[model samples]
Target chain A: MDADVKQHQMKLIYDRYVRYLFIASACLMTIIILAIIIFVGQQGLRTFTEVSVSEFFFTTKWDPMEGQYGAASFIVGSLYVTLLAILLGAPLGLAGAVFMAKIAPSWLREIMRPATDLYVAIPSVVYGFVGLTIVVPFIRTQFNVSSGFGLLAAGFILAIMILPTIISISEDALRSVPRPLEEASLALGATRWQTIWKVLLPAALPGILTSIILAMARAIGETMAVQMVIGNTPQLAKSLFMPTSTLPSEIVVEMGNTPYGSAWGDSLFLMALVLLLISLGMILIIRRIAQRRLA
Target chain B: MSTGSRLISPKIQDKIATGIMWLAGMVIMGILVTFLFYMLYKGVPVLSWEFITGEPSDIRAGGGVGPQLFNSFYILTLSLLFSIPLAVGAGIYLAEYAGNNRLTDMIRLSTESLATVPSIVLGLFGMIIFVNMLGMGFSIIGGALTLMLLNLPVLVRVTEESIRTVPVHYREASLALGATKWQTIYRVVLPNALPGIMTGLTLTAGRALGETAILIFTAGTTVSRQLPDFDVTAAGETLAVHMWYVMAIGLVPDRIDIANGIGALLIITILIFNLMFTIPGKLLQRKMGSSRH
Candidate 1:
């Protein structure tokens, strides 16, 4: 009887030990986040000692060979591409979501839902390949541009890339609206178009905004596909037709050529730090919006 | 409220709005279909049995992606081998043990942030920590470690969600039957969540296979001409990287065709993996539903 009791006690201890192990694994994410922040922070900040933070932020030139490491141009380039992508993607995705949720036949939704999922699964590299072969050439020929690789190409590809995220999230937001709300809008003599524009969209604004922010974050951080089509110009873009480089693409193009721990490499880390900060802020906003929706 | 206030009648406005929505949907569907068909049309002629089995040649006209294909699977296996246990464990803890607390909140926030971190930044982190700090160099292990980190947040989230979807009553019954908590989870909960977990794993595998920016830095872009060496320290490049190299720097005339072939191969592989899990997932859901009824 005593031996049986002892064996049971050992089993309980073993169970508790395994539970702790699981808890520790769960905490690994926190540890990794902290480690990445600190490591990237340290490397990024080291560059500011050599070049003043203001200069890095304000200067437009990014000639690494000449020792000019200002990231203003890349920052602006990222903003320009992202903004254009949002302009192109948001209306299409929102309208598509509206159609899927409110107007589409059941069969159409079935087809679209899987197609959107597949779009999300399609690799960015493949998108890059398609852009290089088709979109860039088409843009060059149609628009009479000297080079097809520019902000327009990157923005156009990013717009398509972000459509899945926008459509699905906005669709969920639209679907979550109580049917009574739509019924009431229609009962008030509002036409279907008016009700959708003035009522459904306003009600779903927060969720739609969340989706937009997430898509913007994706557009800003997109590296390889943009790199392939963006023409890799280091200067501030004069127009959508002109070539430019964003922060991530700049890092990808130069990180290998630049010696590790050099001013240029550290500058790339600083850009990454900038990217991280922007994304973290966006995540926090998303979380807040989500919590608000729950409440 | 005036008659001339609106140029179009409400009926016409409704029609126009509906028309625009339909156009948007058609455009979305049209883009995806065109991309798939165009890629297949361009790539199919180049894809042959010899292309799949032959070694890649630097100067020759008919080099294949044989070694690169092997390395892609190799790195994916290594990463998944390391990631699954930790992710599953973390998932279990979050689903079953974590109460609504600050620690749980922090974990969720960290996972969210990690998910949003760009692949290139993670590659830089991997370059710093795994390759340089750990002295692993640019090798399969380093790349795998990076990929594991990249996929862990998604895996954990999916696993936690799947476990949570297993009815609470199931756990309660197991406990009432005098089963240990770990045994209850291992035997009852995990089995029920297996389909969902499998779906998540397949998606993660697809992501790992198509990843490029991360591997470019951690797994240096050198393809071993021979059959893949299992050594973790050896540099490796996957199909995505191979496509990137061929398109960007490969001066060969047939580079575009080669890239097209790789892209088609990648799309087909991903499509297969997705379908494999999704079909099983649908069947599992139906079975669970009927059993409950």
Candidate 2:
């Protein structure tokens, strides 16, 4: 009895120590996040020391070799492609979500579910390769454009990339809209279309919006696929078919050439910071939507 | 005419709406099929024993990606090695120890923020710390360390989710039988959660295998001369990165063929990874699931 008591005491001490270990591992995530923000901000802010903040966000010229560091074009280009991608992706993704959640037979749903997951698994670099080989040429010849690499090509590729994100989350949202509400609508003599649009869509609006915002975040930060097709020119897009550059793509294109401490390299870091901030802001918006739904 | 159309029936509208839904599904699937076929068609013709193991040429025609192919698995292995334990520990904490407290809230926020930080931004972070500050230069070690950041949030989220699926009764019974909290988790909870966790791991590995941007800067886009180089400090270009490099800046005459081959190889590997999870995941679920209850 005395030895057993001693062994139990030892076990209790070990358990307490293990709990601390788990807590430390969890805290490490916070420390790493803080490190990223601080380090990226420190390197990125060095660009403003040479080029004023206003010039970086307002001017179009990006000739870093000649000391011109204006980044208005890249910022604007990112905004345009993101919006275009959302416009094309959201409707189609939402339609698919509704079909999977409400309309599709169970067997078809099972098949398409993995199909969508596999779509997400397709590497972005492969998407870029496809854009370069097929989409760029097809756009050029079909549209009678001088070049096919521009906002349109990048936006089209991104729309496809973000489809799975929107579809999966929105499907979950639609599926969770209590069956009683659907039955009530049907009992009132509403058609299936009216029940979905008027009853289900409004009830699940917050969740659907969250998915859209997340998809928008993904589209904005997409670097490899956009870099491959966006033509990497610093000009503001004259038309959908004209060559342009986004913040992420511009950074990828130039980071290899510039030395790490040079203003050119720092400017790329700043672009990355801008992308980081935008995505973080979207996350906050998503949390707000979730809180509203809970309340 | 509009009033007459409305008078025609709600039945017609529902049918039309249903038709539109079917069309949307068809369009999405159509795009997926076309893209897959296009990649495989352009790539499969370029694969061979020579291309798989031959040395890459600088400006010559018939270069292969032997070094890059090796480094991809090498770095991926190192990253999974680094991330899995830390993430699992953190995940167990969230699922088992964390209560509704300020510390737990902060941890959750940090994980979400880490996930949202774009991969390119993560690349720069890795390059800043590992390559420039730490003096590793562009190397396999730097790349693997950065890739761990990409993997951590994903692994933690999955592990937490899988652990949550284990019934609370098992934990209560273990504790009632004099097992400590850690023992209950180690011997009972983890075993029950293994199937889902394994599936999550398989998916994470697939994503890491094809990851390019993070490796591009940290690994420095240049492969070492030695095949199967064990040196962690050597340059580690991956197949995905190789495809991008060939398209963007490679001077080799057979650049197109090389890119196609790498693309096809990556796709084939994705298919295999898919099989690895779905089959074993189902069998394990059937075997262990009933026992867990």
Candidate 3:
């Protein structure tokens, strides 16, 4: 009886410790996020020793060779591409979501859903390569621009890259709307389109909005694809077709050339910090929306 | 009829809307299909046994991608190895242990935020923490450690989701039988969740296999001279990074061909990897008789 009791005691103690182990594992996630922000922030903040915050955030003069470090162009360029991608991609994603949720036969949904999943699996580098070979040239020739590697090209690539996120999320949102609501609308002499737009859409708007903001966050932070197609020019673009660099693009383009602690390197780290903060802010925004939804 | 519907009846509008949605689906599918075909068309001719198995050359015309291919799998395996336990542990806490409270929500949000951190930023973090601070120095271990960050959020999410899908009755039955909570989770819940977790892991692995930015700085865009070099300290350039290097800065005369071949190989491997899990996953589900389908 004592031996059996000992085995049971060990099991009980082991179980308790394992629960603490799980809790610690979760805590580690919070630690990683804080560590990234601190380290990236620490390195990036050093750039201000040489360049003023106003000049860094508000002006476009970025000649690191001469110690000037204004970064307005990269910041603006990131916005232009991210917004343009949403403008291009979100409507199609919504339509695709609706089609999958309310229109497509189950067989079709089965096929397309996996195919869409494959979209996320494809590498950003491959998308960039395809954009370089096909979209950039097509843009250059079709628009008669000097070059096609610019906000337009980058936006086009990012739109495709973000489709899976938008579609999957919004589809779930739409699917979650009660079927009785749709049925009531249809039974009240409303067309299917009316039911989707007036009843289903209103119900799912919060989730759809969440998906859009999340997609925006993704579009803003996409690096290799944007870098390859945006031409990595530090100057602001004069036209959609003109070349300009976003934060991620410029960082990748110049990171290899700069040494570890030089002003140039710190400035690049600062740019990465900016990207990180923007994404963190996005998480807060998403959390707000989720809370409002629950309330 | 409403005022707006006077000119265009609801019936006609529904028809048009249906057509438009169908057109949207068609267009997206068309683009995806065209892109895949274009990649395969340009890449398949460059692929060969030699291309798959030979050493990469510095400036030569016909350098193979053998090293990069090996590094992709090796780094992927190592990253998954490092991340799966911690992520699964956290996931179990979220799904089975923690109350549905703000604390759990905050924990979940932190994991999701990790997902939102750009790969480029993560690359720099890895570079700072592993490459410089720890002095792992452009090694597979350094790259794998950084890439593990990318893997963690996805694994935790899938794990929580998979665990949640295991019916509540399964747990209740185990507890009713006087089984300890840990035993119930380990023996019943995890086994039922295994198929889902496996599928999710394969998907995450597919995504990781083609990751470039995280590996670029952390892994140091160069490879060991020896074939299949297993030194954890050796530079671990992967297939995706190799393709990017081939285009961006490579001076190799056959850089374009190399890029194409690598691109095609990446897509093929991802397809195989995803399918690998799916078939076995279904079989496992059937063997378990868990009623998932």
Candidate 4:
């Protein structure tokens, strides 16, 4: 009888111990989260205050050798290329997602979905090599240019690279819309196309936009592929057909040589901080959207 | 009404849309197919056993990336060894123990953002923290550590998802049998999640194998001549980095011919790994579905 009472007490103690372990584990996660954000902040902020913030944001020239390193050219180049990629990519990606979601037969979706997932796992370097061999040569021959690399080629490569992200996310978004809404629209004498444009699209707009921004963030940070195809020219190019520099290309090319007394290193850090902010903003927006949807 | 109806029938529009969709699919697939074609075209002709086995040499005579290939495997294995267990432990803790609360959400958000953080930024962190702060020279260990960090978030997410998929009834059954929580999770939950864990680890290994930029800042470029005697903690070049250096610096002009060959090999290896992860899960799903029916 005494042994049985001891066993019951032991069980109570073990239960409390398990709860303690759970709380400790939760604390560990919180600590790691703080560590990552704090580290990024420390590294990023250390460099930003070292240089003129306006010069980093506004100027067009980026001659690291001459010590005139404004990220303006890189920023413009990044935005322009990303914008071009979205213009080319989002519509096609949306169409593809919609087709797979609403139009494709079940067998086709089964085949294509796996194929798309496989596409996402292919590394950026292989994509770079692909862009180098196929896109570069095609551009050179068609445009009769001296350099095979061009912004258009980079944008096109990025568009392809981002397609899977857009497609998968948009497909999920579209899939989540209630079927009753579509049924109701159809019953109200609306055509399928009308139902799609007026009903389904409006419902999925936020998610589709989220996917777009996510893709844009991806395009901005993509390094190796864009570096290979963008010609790594530091100067801003007027035409999409011409080669230009983006923030990622600049960081990759210039980080190797710290170039003492030059703020190029600091500039690189600032660019990274900007990229981080953009990604953080994206996540916050996504969390809000997800919360509202869940609610 | 007759003219308007004839101009654009619902059937006609649907047909056109379907046709356009098919055309778009074909075009995009064409790009992917063309890429594979070009890689094969440029790569296959030059691919010989000697080319694969030889050591990389001077600018004039292109040499083999034998050393780089070995380094890649070593770095990949080491990175996976370091990351998989830590991430799995952390993941199990998250999925099984931690409640769905603000703290857990914060951890998850940080991890997701970490996933989006550019490889270059991670590379920078590695340079500062691993190379400079830790006093580790640009060596294989530093690169491996950096790669481990880079792959951690993905592994954690995958592992957590896999663990969560283990049926609740299994846990309840184990508890009912008088097992402790730890014992139940260890015996029932982990065994069930093992295949999925392997899938995640395989994908992570594939990424580590292909990584270059992070290694560029962390791993120094001195390629050791001997294979078996090679110390991984020391600086060495891997296959992907070798290819990048070959093209960018043109340090070995003759070896540039083999770049595509090396790339093709890497891509094929990664594709195989991806299939290993995805195909099994898919086949298992199909089997389950058929059995249910």
lDDT of 3 at B157: 93
Q: Estimate, for each residue in A50-146, the C-alpha lDDT of model 2 and write its tens digit.
A: 9999999999999999999899999999999999999999999999999999999999898888788788789999989999998999999999998
Sort by DockQ, best first: 3, 2, 1, 4
As for candidate 4, its clashing pairs are B62-B254, B62-B255
Q: Give each model's clash number.
A: 0, 0, 0, 2
- Once fitted onto the true fold, the runs of candidate 3 whose alpha carbons sit more than 4 angstroms away are B1-4, B100-102, B282-293
Chain B TM for prediction 3: 0.95
Expressed as tens digits, the lDDT of each residue in A37-134 for candidate 4 is 56656765655555567876888777767867577878888888898889998888888888888887898888777666656666677788788877
lDDT of 1 by residue, B89-198 (tens): 99999999999999999998998898888888888889899989999988989999999988899899999999989999999999999888998999899999988898
What 10-residue stretch in candidate 4 chain A is worst by lDDT? Answer: A24-33
Per-residue lDDT tens digits of candidate 1, residues A1-295?
Answer: 9998898788889899999999999999999888888898888889987888888999997777888878999999999999999999989999999999889999999889878887877878898899999989999999999999999999999999999989998999988888899999999998888888878988898889988998998889888889999999889999888989999889888887888899888999999989888888899999999889788
Candidate 2 at A225: error in angstroms?
0.4
Identify the superior model by TM-score, candidate 1 or candidate 4. Answer: 1
Question: Who is ahead in DockQ, 1 or 2?
Answer: 2
Please report how far candidate 1 places residue B180 from its true position, in Å. 2.6
Alpha-carbon shift of residue B116 in model 4 (angstroms): 0.9
How far residue B67's Cα lies from its native spot in candidate 3, in Å, is 0.6
**Over the stretch B1-293, how does candidate 4's per-residue lDDT look in tens digits?**
24655789866766677777666666656666676667667777777887777877866565887777878888888888877766776788788886778867777777777777777777777777778778887878888888877788888888899999888988999999987787787789987887778777776777778887778888866577686435756786788887777676656656547678788778777778877776786677557546645
Evaluate model 2: give its TM-score. Answer: 0.98
Q: Which residue pairs clash within candidate 2?
A: none
Q: In order, what lDDT does every prediction score?
A: 0.89, 0.92, 0.92, 0.76
